[model samples]
Target chain A: MSARDAVLGAVKAALGRSRPADPADPAAVAAEALALLADPDAVRPALPGTDAAVAFAARVVSPKVGATLDRVEALADLPGAVRRYLDGQGLPHLLALQPDPALQGLDWAGFELRDAALPDEAAAFGLARWGIAETGSLVFHSGPDTAVLGHFLPLHHIAAVRASTILPHLEDYAAVCGAAPRNANLITGASGTTDIEGSYVRGAHGPRFLHVLLVAD
Target chain B: MGTVFKRDVARALSDATLKTAIDRTTVTAERKRAAALTDYPQFAAARERGTRIKDHVVAHLDHYLLEFERNATASGATVHWAADSEEACRIVLGICRGAGARRVTRSKSMLGEEIGLPHALEAAGIERVETDLAEHIVQLAGETPSHIIWPALHKTREQVSALFKASHRDPHKTEDVEAMVESARRELRDRFLSAEVGISGANFLVADSGAVCTVTNEGNAELTTTPPRVHIVTAGIEKLVPSLAHAFVLLRLLVRSATGADLTQYTTFHCGPKRPGDLDGPQEFHIVLVDNGRSRMLADAGLREMLRCIRCGACMNHCVVYRQIGGHAYGATYPGPMGAVLTPALQGAEKARDLPHACTLNGRCQEVCPVGIPLPALLRGWRDRSWKDGLVPQSVRSGLWLWRFAAERPRLYHLGTAAAVRAMRLFRRGGWIGRMPLAGAWTRYRDFPAPAGRTFMEQLRDRERGR
Candidate 1:
């Protein structure tokens, strides 16, 4: 038997069945599993947040959030916010930007822009498709526009997400993240680890700094 | 069997470093767990939902496993199945050889450890570097992971600093934690950027969309999978949830129960190799699902609940036996109450009979268990099986037999206990027995209370006579 057959057959045997789909009086195991997939709305925890944007902003900028945030009135205002955040953190304004359309049509007179973030690059910019409020997570979908390296390679990651795209919870993103994203990253905060004897370290492997730009428009 | 474990634990008990490290992590984790649950009152409900989802998936694993394979293939990823650990190692080795991978970068994987993947790689002449900070420390020290979450937290800071200085060959080394972390980051960055293959363990597999999800606080997993030419995910068949929604529900329970965090710093899902025009991701994506005795576990209804483990390390953090002796004493891939039950089921009740007997049946592990595994009951079940299989120690078996013989005879039991109570008084020193013959092990650490002059049965009889 194929390894798949042998393995699944083992399960079938465990469940007291001879095959995946049997015509026994009891419901076939395959059919029962398919029935579960039909219903996507599983039980969700009762988190206290009715308004998505408010909860998201509060969480992203919370005192112990390990990340910084800036709320821009429009998508066009994101450049100014990023500039201000860079200036505030004493980081260089030069950034390797993901070649995304959502990032175009912006005035970039002062800042030097480059392609996908280099391994030792100080900062990188990317656009997020969705933001989750419950944990203040940014959902990055890899495609022609978004460079997966921009999410990890740089020391600082500036992710921009529209406030209107902020979902109240992670389960809500499942409905929005339909079949398009072959690769999706739900980053809750900056890369960190308490592995060294429970002492918190901000940058363990990836970006040490995660700054989220909430585009109000 | 008892002699081996007794030796291992005897060494662990005397190791001052191990005791200090265990006390720190367990106490901090328990405190954080309480605080996180307090902030989020819905944790109880989320845990219940997570357990129910796992139960449903385990019951119908055959369908979901096939569904995961089909959907993953549809997304341009290859899915391989392994009936056991050897086949799983061979498949991973074959992938690396086919890719001509000289060097590989890896995130921490419990399944990888279970299958002895590191040894396989070493034997096949492939060099692999562990990217997780804790895992990297353990690798340099040439030891298996003790704790699941804090893989190498058992080592002291001085030990970690020394390990780095020796491994990295740095002359200007200090005992500072931050400097050590920076050293690892700098040392591993080139490997992450250069490795041909990156192997990671899946935290959960979404059967609905075939997303191999990995949850980690460190960004090592992200960097490991992103820059490599090939990304191979090694996961157990039991790590499946029905959909992304169900996954989030479990994610809620996992983070809080593990480290008292609201969520993991990073939870990435890879649906396929890469999208049409992705700039930088693995060109090839493959997921190897290993059975490795999980089928045997599923077949046994009594031991089936062991499969619900999310490996958050909560049970170990709160276990009475684990706190006393720590993970290395368990002498298995997994440790603590979960390991106590799972190790025997996977290895055999006879080989690891000492495991089930290690538990004090305190029930603290199950109380803190995110998926609500009845650990005390499971430990009891293993003990019962050990007794039936004659794997229990001869002394314990005979002692129980003697108790049962007396317990069955009420008059003789009263007479025997009355005489035993009088004998116990001989060793009495003031309020407690400092020493007792043939039972010195009982008072080895703690004084045994002096028995009353008469057995309770005799006193009860006198009271009934209205004396």
Candidate 2:
């Protein structure tokens, strides 16, 4: 018998399930698992009673993750928000941006923007596919427009999260992530490590500063 | 793996450096975990949900495992099954050899340690690099991990500096934490960029979408899973959850219980190998699900609850014995209260008979356990089994038998206790017993308390009679 058969058979014999179901029958197994997934009785935490954008902004600036948050009234105001955030942090006005159409039409008056790769010690910007308000994490799906490298490999990371896309809990966000992107990163804040003498130090191997721009309609 | 608990604990206690390191780190971790839970108002509900989800999954494990395999295969990844550690190691080595991988980079994986993967790979001439900062320090020191979450919690800054100085080319590096972290970042960056294969342990294996979720604060797991051509995920069969929603429920409690963080810095999900338009990711993805004595645990109802562990390491942090003796004393891949029950269950009661007796019956581990495992009860069950199997020491067995004989009858019990108290009074120095014959082990450290003028029953009877 195969290793899979031996392992599954052992589990069945241990469970003492009088008659074991065939594991090779994908349709029956999938149907059972899909029923659980389709309507999961998940325990969702009580979200903040404030607006979605307000909750997202508050959590993003919380001490746990330590990411700065900026709310803009419209997509047209994104460039100003990014410029002001960079100037406030005393960062240079150069960035590497993912090739998303939502970010393309922005007027780059005083900034030097590049594509495909993150520049050395520079900031990078990407659009978040969704925002989880409970943890203030920005969910980014890897695709042609959203470069996975742009999420990491930079000293500073700035993500644009539309207020409309902010979900109250992780269960709500799970609904939006059902399509199964090739790679999805739910980055809570800047990279940190407490490995050395149990001290919290930012920028272990990823971006040191994470700035979120909350774009409101 | 044998019963060397006494010798191992003696060595750990003498190491003043390890004691100080564990003292400082566990205190901070315990405080942070408490504070993080306070910040989240719904932590209790989340923990309950996590326990229920795990219990449900373990009940129907075969279906979920098959579901995960089918979905992962559909997403262009290969899934392998291993009934034991040897098969798991063989499959991992086979994958590396097939990929022509000479140098492999890995994140911190407790499962990897459980199966002794590093030794197997090294024996086969594959260079394995541990990318986690704590793991890297332990690897360089040629020591096993002393703590589960914080592997290098047993090392001092001076020790870490010495290890790094010896391993790396930085001869003049100072003994500063930031400088040490920067040096490791610089050194491991090259390994991540050039490694042929990357191996990581999954925090959760989602059956719905065939994703392997990894939570890390240092972002090393992300780098390890990325950049390499072949990414291999080695996880135990108990890691399966039915859906992403169920996974989120456990993830919410895991970070708080482990590090007191609202969420880790990175919770990346690797759904499968690189998709059609992906720019940079692993071209091939493989997941190795290893049983390694888990099915045996699942068979016995008394020990089945041990499989509910999420590898959070909270039980160890709150354990009184563990805080004093540290993880090295356990002499196993796992340690502390969870290890006390799980070590024997996984590696039979006969081989690890002393592990169950290592505890003080303190229920602090059960109190702080996120999954609500009755650890003390399980340890007591193991002790009972060992006694039945005659695996206990002869002295212990005889002492218990003598106590049982005297206690079964009221007259004999009263007379036995009265005579023992009178004899103890003879040897009392001032108010404490400074030394005793049969209890040299107990009296060697400190004085045993002397009995009062009368036993409790005599005092009670005198008070009731108005004497």
Candidate 3:
């Protein structure tokens, strides 16, 4: 086939046709695009603030959310808040997986703890640093100090997220990386499988419930 | 030659049952993700971090993967290296056989799909059950995944209900998602407990601690990894990060990009086999690292960035064409922008010649990509490669030559444009073109709005004289 025929064939395959007019007026196309943007269903709308985000979360995550997974603005002492929450839960026998230096001097006396140790089969909790976030997800990276099983092997998981480390768009994340890395994952949520007849099951290979400890110092 | 991808996609789209199923499922995920990412400034930064970490990792992949192997082995976890899909499959199967595993539960892993591992396992008298909600549907129906995030999006509730009735021990006919979920949960719970071995894919493998990270919304990955005596993690070679701190950088970008989640309900990390002090964990842990064609991707600077992808499927979700055509059309394990570049590059030019050119060259995929891969540039590169390799039809080369000739001469270009305008005007009816000779396929479903008289340049010239 001639090059023209090849291009046409490819175009035909793409459009399922022979020849497509490559639009006439560029400005008119832009105008049409702008008009399409007006439709609520056409383009994604701009993000709302804390209240709006909470409302959206309520709609999607749970309509009857009580308190444990509540939304709060960036806190000054996030690690402390996490410690306090764990203390209140009456379960502070934690096996911290990948705690950062930012959490160096937090005091937890009355509770038996394994700070950044290998996840024991009986570890109450496996704490690790998250690599990504979206819709309240805490990502975990596997390595020597932290076992891939650490995040899942433990009954409870607490992820320490620095508030400053968030992005609005996936494309923005791509821009930051610029190229493929040796290893990385963009986790939106915890380990889940819908393998059984499309049923959504949580904590299949990892944790059953995920709690994000947003630490902003 | 059969345009395998085109044929499959056409079959899928034409199948009303599949189209409805896909549309319903993808629409829901798209909306939920939009809501989750909205109003979160941190999401933007996380995505940037994810991109940067992957870029750095890919640039120094040999260093990182070797580092990971050393660290993971030190942690008492066996790490097997595979240079290609075949090697990867062999290594995994060998481990399964060594452990004397008969049945295995798997969380959703696209890499597994790419290598066709399940079929290979089944041939060896091993039953591999897909434990992901969407994956189960496709596996039951004996169909390929229609979308990246929501594999069974192409199936309707009614169809799923029927499938559940046949498959579930006690199935209900209700369309209620909760009821359906409960039914599936009960069935899978048994499989999770009974299975001797579990297989999973890693989102990232941290080198510092010898950990494998699997992130999901359903929590099936945890069950697949634990409970079972032996847990096997199969991941691409590129899924290695330097440290846990580095893993954090990528997490911020992955979840929001994949499903717009701040954090999935279960983001578990697994280090190795169950320790002596552990209660209920796998006794044997093995990680199978599959290189496939990633090494080739890493060697080339222009295409290496594609490896940084977190497999979030954001590009596919946001793509106008993909949203319309769906995943099966790509005819590869991957089905969107990333697939278009990666599949052809990994598999070869002959297998996926149509994929690269089957796009509108829109920048939406690039716009939403979490790892900053220049998809259009990469797609164009594939097209160039296909042409050079003689994979493209003779007609295409001739067309390009003619177009190039016309482009170099102002007179021919203007004349051609004028002719096009005239031809388009002839097809006008009711302010739109219902059907045209060559572009019949597009007009079959959607009408093309007719252009105003004269081209933009012509109008501009006229305006210069105050028309």
Candidate 4:
């Protein structure tokens, strides 16, 4: 028997089942999975009001999460907001722009931009599909348009989140993303570590800063 | 007591630096966890919800494991099953060899440490770099991880600086944390870009979504798995949750309990390798389901509750005994209250007989446990089993027998207790015992106060006569 058979057999034996699963009937396992997921909402934690985008912003910029936010009035103003953030932080105009239509399609003038983030790039921009109020998380889906490195390669990761996409709780993330993408990256704040001497050091490997461009629809 | 654990504890106690590190980190972590929980009152309900999900998953392990296999396979990922650590290592090594990988990068995987994956890769002539800062520090120093969450929790900043100096051969600043972190990033940035394979431990395996969810504070897990050609996730069979929704419940509680943070900086749900037109991601994705001793744990209903552990390290943080000796004294892949029960359960009762005795039976670990595993009760159960298996040392067994003999005879019990109190008083100076025989372990850390030189019966009789 294969290792799979032995493992499943061991589990079956522990559960007091008579035999290993039939090789041909693979759907039986999928059926079992669907049954368990049937009540996915059976258990949920209480959350803030559904219209708590302001609360979400509060949590995001809290000292513990340590992320800064910028709210824009329209999609067209995103580039200007990014530029404003860069100028405020004393960063340069050169930044890596994620190769997505929603971002790349924007008319980015006056700023030197690369299609994808370079290893040594100082800043990069991407779009979050949803914002979680419970944890102040940005949900990004990975696909042909979404370059996974755009989130990790740069020192400063600038994300554009639609104000209308904010959800009250973390559970809303699965409902929105649906687990269909290749990967769902839910980042809560700037990267940090206390591994050296139990002292917090920001920007360990990922970006030191996560500045959000909360665009109002 | 297990001889190995006893000697390890004795050796660990002398390292004053280890004690200080453990004291500071555990206190800080516990305070942060408390503060984080207070900030989110729903955390109380969330932990209960997490327990419900995990309990269901553990009861129906076979169904979810098979379901996970089917969905992952459909998503263009391969799922391998390993009944033991050796099998797990062989499968990972086979993947590396198939990719013709010369260098590999791995994130912090307690399962990897349990299965000795890094050593297996090294013995195969592969250069494996641990991407997590704590992991890198220990790997560079040629040492095993001292803590599950913080591997180099025992090492001081100077020690880490020394280790980096020896390995990187750089004059990185010793006092500045950022300079040291920057040095590591500079050295590892190229390795992450060039490595052929990346290995990570799964925080949760979603059967419905066919995703392996990983939680990281530093985002090293994403960098480790994303940039490589082959991404291998080795997780225990018990890591499975039914769907992403259930995983969210546990994720909220886990981050708060572990780091005292609202959420980890990065929590990525990876469903497959790379999609058909993805610009960047590992081309090959594999999930190895390991069942080293979990099947046995499942077979025993009483022991099965432990499979619900999220590896939060909260139990260890609150454990008084863990605060003193730290993780190394347990001398196992896991340590503290969780390790005391888990080491013997996974390995055997005879192999780690001393571990169960190491805990003080305080209910703090269980109180703080997110999954509510009844850790003290489990340790006590192990102690009872140790007695029956004759795993308890002969000296302890004889001592218990003598105490039981006197207890059955009430007259002798009173006489024996009265004599012992008088003898204890002889060693007292200023109402405190400077030294006590056969209780050296108790007094070694603190002074023992002298008891009144009388039994409870004598004291009661005198009080009644005076009245």
Name every residue pair that clashes in candidate 1. none
Every model's TM-score: 0.94, 0.94, 0.72, 0.96
Full-model lDDT for every candidate = 0.85, 0.84, 0.64, 0.85
Ranking by TM-score: 4, 1, 2, 3
In terms of DockQ, which candidate is stronger, 3 or 4? 4
lDDT of 1 by residue, A1-217 (tens): 8998899888888878765674234246546544543433333444455888888888888744667888888888978988998898798889898788778668777999998787789999888988988888998888888877788878888999998998987868877788837678888888888887777777788888899998989
For candidate 2, lDDT tens digit of each residue in B269-361?
888898877777899999999998999999988888888899888999888889878998888789999999988876778878888888899
Give me the candidate number with maximum TM-score: 4
Instruction: Give me the iRMSD of candidate 3, please.
Output: 13.3
Candidate 4 — which residues are off by over 4 angstroms? A19-50, B169-171, B465-467
Interface RMSD of 1: 2.6
Better of 2 and 4 by lDDT: 4
B177-208: candidate 1 lDDT, tens digit per residue: 77888788888888899999999999999987
TM-score of 2: 0.94
Residue A98 Cα positional deviation in candidate 4, in Å, after optimal superposition: 0.8
Q: CAPRI verdict on model 4?
A: medium
Candidate 2 local distance difference test against the native: 0.84
Distance from true location, Cα of B235 in model 1, Å: 1.0
Ranking 3 against 4 by lDDT, winner: 4
Query: lDDT tens string, model 4, A1-217?
Result: 8888888888888887766653324366445544544443343434445466886888789886789998998888889999999999899899888777887777799899887788878999988889988788998888888887889889999998988998877766777676468888998998899787567899888999999888888
Model 1 global lDDT (CA atoms, 0 to 1): 0.85
The TM-score that candidate 4 achieves is 0.96
